[model samples]
Target: MSVSKQADIAPTLRPPPALPADGMVISANFSVGGFSKRWNHCHQLANFLARYASANEDDPERHATLLSTFFNELLEAIYRNHGATGEIKMRFRKKQNHILVEAEVPINEQSAKFYNHAVQLANQPDPMAWYREQLEHDVPDDDAQALGLLELAVVYGSKLSISEPTSGDWLLLAIQFPFTEVEEL
Candidate 1:
C-alpha cells in the first residue's frame, strides 16, 4: 500500500495581509495574456524586477542575477499552471533583512493540486535529495514537478509556502528570501 501526503484541497487560498511600507514595496497585476501570449515576458519581467530590487545590494550585479533566476522560475511556474482567464498579481516587499515575493495565481483544481503537492515536497525533511531524484528520473507530468520551489528552498534557504485561497479559484504562493544571505551570495 502506498501512503499519500497530499493536503486536503481548500475552497480558496487567502492572500496575505499587506506588508508595512517601512522599506520597499512593488506591486503589479497583469492580464493573463501578458504571460501566456509571449513566453519571454517571464524573463523580461524577472530581469526588470530583479535589477530594480537589487540596486542597493552589496553585490548588485550578482544579486540581480540570482533574483532574476528565481523570479524567472516563479513566472514560468505561473505561466504553466494558471487557469484559462485571470489576472496574475505580484507583490515584492523588502523590510529589514527579509525580502518577500508573493504571487496570487488563478488556478483550477488541477493546478491547485500541483502547487499543493509541490509545497509538500518542498517542505519534506530531505527535499534536496528529492530534488536530485527528480532530476535523475523521468517525470511525465512536468508541470506538477515543482522544481522551482524545491530549488529555492533547498539551495537558497528560501521558505516556500501556500496560503489563503482567494474567493475565486486562486493559490497564493509565497517565496521568501533571507536578504542578508542573498546579498552575501
Candidate 2:
C-alpha cells in the first residue's frame, strides 16, 4: 500500500483593490538602456516603500501621502541619475505623479528586456483564461479585453492575451506601460 502525500499550493494573490468594471488602461513604450535600469531600480524602491507604508495602519491617508512623496523623490533621483538636465516632463493625476525621462545614450539591452518581458506576459494563463470565460458568457469582447489588459499591466507589467470563450478564438493582444503608482479612486 502506498500513501499519497498532500502538497499545499499557495493561494493566488489578487490585485490589491478589486479593479472596476470600466477602468481604463493606458500605456507608453520607450527605448532607453539606462532609463530601463533606473526604472527597474525605481520599481524595487517603490515596492519597498509600499511595504513600509502598510506596516502601520493608524492613519491611512498619512500613509498614502508619505508613499506619494517618496515615489516622487525616487523618480526624481532616477531621472537625474540618467542625465536629465532640463525641466522634467512630469504629470500629476488624481493620485499619482508620472515623470517621463529620456536618456542620451542608447540602451539596447534595457530596451530588449522590456520588450521581451512585455511579450512574455501577454501570453500568460490568468489573462487568457479569464478573458475567454468572460467572452463565452456574452460579455462585450472589447470591455473584457480592456479589463484583462489593465489587470495584466498591474499584476505583471506588460503584455496580455484574451480569447472569446464560445468559439475559443483569440480576440485581443495588449501591451501595457509600467506605471509608477496605483491607488484607489
Highest lDDT: which candidate? 1
Model 2: how far is 140 from its true place, Å?
36
lDDT at position 79, candidate 2: 41
TM-score of 1: 0.80
Query: Which pairs clash inside model 1?
Result: 12-165, 13-164, 13-165, 13-166, 14-164, 14-165
Q: Please give, for residues 1-185, the per-residue lDDT of candidate 1 as tens digits.
A: 75655564454443443444346567879878767888866788889898888766666688788888888888888887888888989998886666788999888887888888888888999988877887888755742358877788888888889985557578799988766566454
The number of residue pairs in model 1 that clash at the backbone is 6
Error of 1 at 18 (Å): 21
Worst 10 residues of 1 by lDDT: 12-21
Best candidate per TM-score, number?
Answer: 1
The reply for model 1, stretches above 4 Å from the true place, is 1-22, 140-144, 166-168, 183-185
Supply the TM-score for candidate 2.
0.23
**Tens digits of lDDT, candidate 2, 94-145:** 2222222121221133323332343354455565565556657876633432
